[model samples]
Target: MKILLDFVPLVLFFIAYKLYGIYAGTAVLMGATVVQMAIIYFMDKKLSAMHKATLALILIFGALTLILKDDRFIKWKPTVLYAAMAVALAVALWGFGKNFLKMMLGNQITLPENVWVRLNTIWVVYCLFMAAINGYVAAYYSTDAWASFKLWGYVFPLAFIIGQGFYVARHIVDDTDKPAEPPGDVQ
Candidate 1:
């Protein structure tokens, strides 16, 4: 549900571009971004956390693209946002002594610290790849193709992540040295 909210603007942008034009879609995404941020601020705990900063950037640059009436600007937004997120994740992992990935997803599965770092690196590299892919599509592909990719390209990665979660969960060591499982429920 929350993931869909994060994706709403991109979806809208794509649809608008298909029906109207780049500028029109940009306008729609801009409005959606404002709404997204408002939800992030007001509904942090109840709904979803605020990791849509990259999406917000997309919206802003989309607006700039509309106002400037240049497709290049809008095309650049995703690349910049993706690269920026990659850097931010790397910094959080190593330099800032933070573990954002863990915060976002650790509790559900457990793994070694090294695995976490490697996964973190994978995430950064993945973002970079995403940026490049977006650029390629925007520059060479038709708007319809770009929008289709935008809508569907997310599935493989999401499925990969979910599978990795299961793999990691299977390997977790119950090293707390207590009962094999938490209290309550059937034996």
Candidate 2:
């Protein structure tokens, strides 16, 4: 359900682009994003920082695309978002000595400190790679080509997530396997 909600705006944008054009598609994207956020807020009763940032970027860039009559803004939005994520992850881990990925997920799963560090590093690198690829496509490709890439580019994230899941699964501890402690009153 959450994943479907997350993809609604992108799917709508692609459909709108196919029927109308960039400008109309931008408008649809912006509206769909707003609706998506509202539903999420109602469901969760709050929004994560990432959710807020994504909403803001979509509205800002989508508006610019429509108002300025430039498809470049929409095309470049993903690059900007991904680059910012990379910078934030890197700075939080190195400059501040904080592992944000761990902070966010530590409650749900426990892993060795070393594994946490490696995961954070992997996230930073992955974000940078995504940003670079999106930047390359947005810079060098036609609008139609970029649109197609936008829809198909989901493959990268899906693969990365499945791979990450496999990696993390190996490290997850199963408490059920531990032996029970002896009673304190044992003779």
Candidate 3:
């Protein structure tokens, strides 16, 4: 359900683009994003920082696209967003000596600190690569090509997630498989 909600705005945008054009698609995207945020707030009672950042970017770029009558603003949104994420992750990891990804998922998954660092590094690299690719495609390609890439580009994240799952799985401990220690052994 959460995954579907996350995708609602993108799906609507795609459909609107196919049926009408970029302007109509942009409008639909803005409206759908608002609806998505509202639903998330109602259900979760709070929004994550990532959600707020996404909402802000969507509104800002969507507004620029509509008001200025230039599709370039919208085209550049994804690149900006991906670049921002990469920078944030890099700063958090290297500058602050903190692994934000591990902080977020540490409770659910246990791994050595080195493994966590590796995972964070992988994400930083992935985000940077995604930003570069999006920028290149948006700048060099036609609008139709960019839109097609937008839809097909989902494969990258999907593949990354599957690979992440496999990587994390190798390090996860199955508590159920271990014999219980005596009460006095608790520490």
Candidate 4:
């Protein structure tokens, strides 16, 4: 359900684009994003920083595309977003000696500090790669091609996540795997 909610805006944008055009798609995307966020807020009672950032970018870039009558603004949004994420993660991890991935998910999943660092590093690299690829397609390709890529590019993240899941699973600590305390000898 949450995944579907997250994707509603993108699917709507694509359908709108196919039925109308980029401008219409942008408008629909903006509206759908707002609706999506509203629903998420209602359900979760809070929004993640990522959600807020994504909403802001969609609205800002969508408005720019509509107002200027140029599709470039909308097309470049993903590149800007991915690049921003990569820079944020890299600077936080290397410059400030912070692991943001661990900060966000530490409570939910336990892993060794080294694993957290490696995960954060992987995220930074992945974001940069995604940013570069999107920028390349957006810059060098036609709008139609770019739109198609936007839809098909879902594969990259899906694969990345599945691979990450398998990697993380190997490192996940299972309480059941630990030796039980003998009788009442709790330590």
Most accurate candidate by lDDT: 4
Model 4 TM-score?
0.93
lDDT tens string, model 2, 1-187? 8877887898899999999999999999999999999999999999988899999999999989988999899999999998999999999999999999899899888888888999999999999999999999999999998988988998888788889999999998676777998879867
Expressed as tens digits, the lDDT of each residue in 4-116 for candidate 4 is 68777888999999999999999999999999999999998999888999999999999999999999999999999999999999999999999889998999898888999
- In model 2, the runs with Cα more than 4 Å from the true position are 175-187
lDDT of each: 0.75, 0.90, 0.89, 0.93
- lDDT (10s digit) by residue, model 3, range 53-83: 9899999999999999999999999889989
Candidate 1 lDDT tens digits, 43-86: 76433333566556766787678787887777677778778878
lDDT of 4: 0.93
Q: List residue ranges in candidate 4 displaced over 4 A.
A: 175-187
In model 3, how large is the Cα lDDT of residue 101? 87
Clash number for each model: 0, 0, 0, 0
lDDT of 1 at 93: 85
Q: What's the TM-score of every candidate structure? A: 0.74, 0.92, 0.90, 0.93
Off by over 4 Å in 3: 175-187
For candidate 4, the per-residue lDDT at 185 reads: 67
Candidate 4, residue 74: the lDDT equals 99
lDDT (Cα, 0-100) at 50 in candidate 1: 32
Poorest lDDT segment (10 consecutive residues) of candidate 3: 178-187
